[model samples]
Each structure stands twice: as structure tokens, then as C-alpha cells.
Target: MTVDYSLPKPELGAPVRVSPFIRFCRWGLLFAGIAYGMKRQRTLEQRETAHRANLRAQKVIWDEEQKKIATQRTREQLLQLAKDVNVPIPADFDTQYPPA
Candidate 1:
């Protein structure tokens, strides 16, 4: 029988054979990932800040609406009082509540 002539393959690639361009691309991707994460964090912080500001604005608006409703209720009660006493109610009766 004729002897086999194929050579045995090596277990691993040669050392220091990694291309410099591929290495640079790997490092560039790593830095890009870090920058992207920081940008996402900043965006989240901005959104939270805006949400807090909106909530504060809404609270102010709610307080003003409540004040108006309370004033109207107070005026209605004073008008009822005047009716019970058979007297004319003052136009500025709303300014007086829990009269002292």
C-alpha cells in the first residue's frame, strides 16, 4: 500500500496574526457602546426633569381650579343666608367666608 501524504493540521492559528484593522474596529465598537449608554442616561434624566416640571404645573392649575370652585360654593351659601334673612346679598359676598 502507498503511504499517506497529507500533513497534520495545527490546533490553533499562528500567534500575533490578528489584523490591526480588526483590532481597531473592536476597540472603536467598545467606546461607541460606552458613549451610547451615557447618552441614554442623560436622555432619561431629562425626561424625568420634564415630568416633574409638568407635575408641578398641573398642581398649580389644580389648586387654582379648586379655589374657584370653593369661592363659588361660598357665594351660593351666603346668598342662601340672605334669602333666609329676607335681605339683599352683597356683590362681594364671595370675599367673606367663615366670617369673623
Candidate 2:
């Protein structure tokens, strides 16, 4: 006689049974997960906001520096042009474009 070794086929219409303890904790687990997610999301949003603010402040400082540099260059160029043409520098020229 031959021995049977094949596993039985699963029934498609069988109902799944959940443990009572797990079912009792389902709502608590869902709420805890949601609470944790919200806390993490809030932390991330705060960090991103702080980073953006830092970038904005840096940009403002950078723009101000660029403007200052441009102003200085323009002043120097004007002074040089006046000297090349043998024009006397106005008394207030130094006051307006104080030495770099």
C-alpha cells in the first residue's frame, strides 16, 4: 500500500477567527498609532519651518551684503573717473563713500 503525503487543500469559503484579546485592543492600538504619527508629523513640520526661517534670514543678509558691495564699487569708480579728468573731489565725497 502507498502512503499518502500530499497536504490537504484549503477551503476558499472558510471564515477567519481573531483572538479575543487582540480584538479588545484594536481600538486602543489604532488610537495610539494615530497619536504617535501626529506627534512625529508635528515635530517634522516644526523643524522644516525653523529651517526655512533660517534660510530666509541668511538670504536677507546676503542681499544686503551684495548691495553694500555694489555701492562701494560704484563709489570707487566715480572717484577714479573724477581723478582721471583732473576734477577736484567734492569735500563731501569722503563722507559719502567712507573708506572701505
Query: Which candidate number would show the highest TM-score if scored against the true structure?
Result: 2
RMSD values for the candidates in order, in angstroms, are 11.3, 8.0
Model 1 error, position 92 (Å): 16
Cα TM-score per model: 0.44, 0.51
Clashes found in each candidate (C-alpha, N, C closer than 3 A):
0, 0
Kindly report which residue pairs in candidate 2 clash with one another.
Answer: none
For this target, which candidate reaches the highest lDDT against the unseen true structure? 2
Query: What is the model-wide C-alpha lDDT for candidate 2?
Result: 0.93
The parts of candidate 2 lying over 4 Å away from their true place are 1-13, 25-27, 71-99
How much is 94 displaced in model 1, in angstroms?
9.6
Tens digits of per-residue lDDT, candidate 2, 18-89, equal 888998799789999999999999999999999999999999999999988988998989989999999999
The TM-score obtained by model 1 is: 0.44
Local accuracy by lDDT, each model:
0.86, 0.93
**How well is each residue in 1-100 modelled by candidate 1, as lDDT tens digits?**
9999999986985777679999999999999999999999999999999999999999999999898788778767777888999998766664565343
